[model samples]
Target: MRGKRDIERELIHAEAKIESLQTLLESAQTDRQELKSQVTKLQDALVAARAPEAYRDQQIAKEEENRTPRDQAQIDKNRLIQKTTEGYMHALERPMDVDDLDALLARSSMHDIKGPPSLHGNDES
Candidate 1:
C-alpha cells in the first residue's frame, strides 16, 4: 500500500480535477444555450424567407406579433444597422484617398470582405 501522504496527495489532485471538470461542464452548458438560441433565430428567419408568397406575409406578421415591442424595436434597429453597413461597403469601392495601407488596416471587422483576421492593431503598420 502507498504511504498516507501519497494517498492524501492523490485524493487532493483528484478533487482538483473534479472541480476543473465541473467548471468546464458549466461553461459548455452556457455555450450550448447560446448556440441553441442562435440556431432558433436562424431557423425562424429561414422559415420566414422560404415560406410561399401567399403565406409569407402571414408568417411574418405572426412572428412580429409574437415579439415584444422592445424585441421588435431591436429587430428594426438591427435591420437598419445592416443596411447602413452595406452602404459603407459600397462606399469603400469608390476611390479611397488614404495613400498608406496602414491607415486602412486601422479598421476592425471589415464590412466589405472576408478571411482576414479582425486584428486592428499595428501588426504591419
Candidate 2:
C-alpha cells in the first residue's frame, strides 16, 4: 500500500513539472516575439533616420557636378565679352595714322573694284 501511494505521488510530481515547463516555454516564446518586434522597430527607425541625410548628400553631389559646367560656361562667356569690349574700346581710343589708313584704303579698293561706285555726285572719295 505504501508503495502504491509513493507511485501516485511521483506521477503527480511529474505532471506538475510538465506544467511548469510548458509555462516556461510560453513565457520564452512571448519574450522572443517582443524582442523580434523591438529589433524590427529599431531597424525601421535607423533607416528613416539615415534616409534624409543620404538623399541630401546625393543631392549635394549632383548639384556640385551640375554647377561645374555651368560655372565654366559663365566664366568663358564673361572672358569673351571682356575681350570683345576691350577690342572695341581699343579701336575707339586710337586714331589711325595716315600710313595705316592708306593701307586700309588700298585693301578696301581691291574689293570695291568688283562693283562700280554710283557716279551721281560720286567722284565721291
Candidate 3:
C-alpha cells in the first residue's frame, strides 16, 4: 500500500539511524579503552603507594644476595674506611696548635724507638 517515494524516504531514514548508532558504538568503545588504561595506571600507582617497608627491605636483601662475596667484602671495607674517617673528623674538630703538633711528633718518635713489642717476649735484636 505504501508509495515508492515513501518507502525510499523510510529507507534513507533507517540508514541514517544505523550510521548514527555505529558512530555512538565506536565512541563508546574508545571511551571504554581509555577508561581501562586509566584504571591500570591507577592500580599501578596504588601498589606503589601502598608498598610496605618490608617489601623494600626484601628487595634490598635480594639485591645484596645477588652480589658476589668479593663485592660485598669491598663494600664492607669501604664502609669501615668511611666510618673511620668520619670518626677522625669528629674527634679533630679544631686545628692542632704547635704544642699539640709537638706532642704528636713526640708520641710518634717514642713509638718508632720502641719499635712494636717483641712478639715472643724476647728483646734480643
Q: What is the TM-score of each candidate against the true structure?
A: 0.41, 0.40, 0.41
Model 3 regions more than 4 Å off: 52-125
lDDT of 2 by residue, 8-116 (tens): 9999999999999999999999999999999987875775578965655556555666764666777677556655554545655778664543444444423244333
Q: Residue by residue across 6-55, what tens digits does model 1's lDDT show?
A: 99999999999999999999999999999999998887677667775535
Leading candidate by TM-score: 1
**TM-score for model 3?**
0.41
What does candidate 3's lDDT look like per residue over 1-125, in tens digits?
57988999999999999999999999999999999999987865665578865556456666767976666678877556655555456547878665554444354423244333353245646
Q: Rank candidates, TM-score, best first.
A: 1, 3, 2
After superposition, candidate 2 runs with Cα above 4 Å error: 53-125
lDDT of each: 0.66, 0.66, 0.66
* Candidate 3: 10-residue stretch with minimal lDDT: 108-117
RMSD (CA, angstroms), candidate 3 = 14.5
Cα lDDT for residue 63, candidate 2? 69
For model 1, the superposed segments whose C-alpha errors exceed 4 Å read: 52-125
